[model samples]
Target: MELRDLDLNLLLVLAELVREKSVSKAAENLGMSQPGMSNALNRLRALLGDDLLLRTGRGMQPTPYAERLAEPLNEALRLIHGVVNLEMDFDPARSNRSFTIAMTDIGEIDFLANLMRALERVAPDVSISTVRKGESNLKDELETGAVDLAIGWLPDLNAGMFQRRLTASQYVCAFRKGHALDKGSITLEEFARADHLVVLAPHTGHMMIEHDLGRLGVRRNVKLRIPHFAAVGHILSETDMIAALPGRLVNHSIVPFNLAWAPLPIKLDPIPLNVFWSAKYHRDPANQWLRAMMFDTFSEGAPHVSPDQAVPLP
Candidate 1:
């Protein structure tokens, strides 16, 4: 079938149908009746000479052909939509749009509170839903719009994916305020000898602290390993185990917990925290607005360690 003979509307229905996997849900999403959606599906199948979707016991499942079409179709539609709205202005105050973001637990500790506070005054109607970074397939998730933005260190991100660096985060050692090692500065021997509390999150693992130490042929005595950052403050407040975490997270905890932090004795390059989005949404007005809001909120008064203070690994 020629492109001119095809009904462009059918493609939209097909995209939604494949995404929702249920005709009724797709129809609701598209603001159309179920019968209309079914008719559109039929037209798409006839024009493409394939049964794009199959009804399984679970729900509507996309055929091999539909699966192949899903990514390019979504990309094409996003480009068309973005071009049409290139000049549009997004008014966050009046719009009640919800955005999905993927970030690590430490990211929530460093960014979420400040971001929410900033949004309260300007974009009261906007809502944010956050998902934990998965062990893999983050790029695919961003491409498919399962996540609107991904924030944190994603070292393996594809070259084609678009990203903007938000800040440079260095590690700091946190301990209870009066701990023995809570001095003006720590020595590499003191840091290596101290018992440590490490976060071994499933998604991002141990934050590469061990690897960084390995490069210097030194390893900390990790006594406890937890999956999340939320428990770090309480654990460190009560125990002598020192935890090395992002400087921003450590700074955020200082007011609430009896936590004292100093620069890590061993040198490790600062990790670049970035916000990643698909090129498909690069020109989307609403997405652009949210990205800018994220950057502005996170970058304002963000703490940084001076270059002169950085100590090289012994």
Candidate 2:
């Protein structure tokens, strides 16, 4: 069917329908009556000459054609919306828009507290939410603008994105304040002999600590293996275990947990922490404002985003 023959408003309903799947939920999401949403779906079906969604035991499921249309449709709408609002200014002070960011627990400790404090001084009305970095759909979420920004040492998000280096971090041997190796330099043999608290978070750059150490023939006497960094400070502070973690995290915890840290015995590449946004929303005024805020607040060394560096993502 020709584009003119179809009512453009129905496309909005189609987008919501395919996204929500259930007509009732779509109607609620779009602030329309359930019957009105059903009518729109009926119109869409008649115009498209296909059963766009079929009801089964698990509620409404989109047909293959509708499923295929979801991404492109959302992308087109996002671009149109961005263009329409391109000239509008984003006043963070007045905007109550909640931004969702993706980061690891270590990032929450190292950055979130300071970011929230900065927000309170300027953008008090704005709210923030966080999702873990390793979510399987993280890239898709960022591309669709569902996630505003992703931060930390995310090497996985390298392709099809705009990134700004926030700072450089390196692994440090963190232990209790009174530990034997806390006073001075720790020898490689000492690090190898000490009890280790290993953080085993996958899809994060922290895993490289073990890989790098092992490559250099340094074996850690692992006493405990945890899946996250949230409790590392507590565990290390109360016990004699040493954890090889990002120096920033250790520094941030030092005051509160009485932690002490020294450089790792082996030299490894510095972990580059970055703030990433999808190429799709790179031109979005709100996104641009947020990116600029992040760069201004956290960037210590790297150059800022320039027109020459804004590349497209797949």
List the global CA lDDT of all models.
0.83, 0.82
lDDT of 2 at 12: 87
Q: How close is candidate 1 to the true structure, as a TM-score?
A: 0.70
Look at candidate 2 and give me any clashing residue pairs: none
Q: Judged by lDDT, which candidate is best? A: 1
lDDT of 1 by residue, 1-314 (tens): 67788878888898999999999999999999989888888888888889998988987799999999999999999998998766877899898989999988778887888789988989999999999866367788888887899987777764767999888787778898999987778888898899999887654524566567777787889899887888999999989999888888888888799789877777778778888999988887988998988988875333455655657764
Candidate 1 clashing pairs, residues 3+ apart or interchain = none
Q: Ten-residue segment with the worst summed lDDT in candidate 1?
A: 299-308
Candidate 2 on 104-213: residue-level lDDT in tens? 89878777777788889889999989988564578889999899999877776888888988887766778999999987567777888999999998877787767877
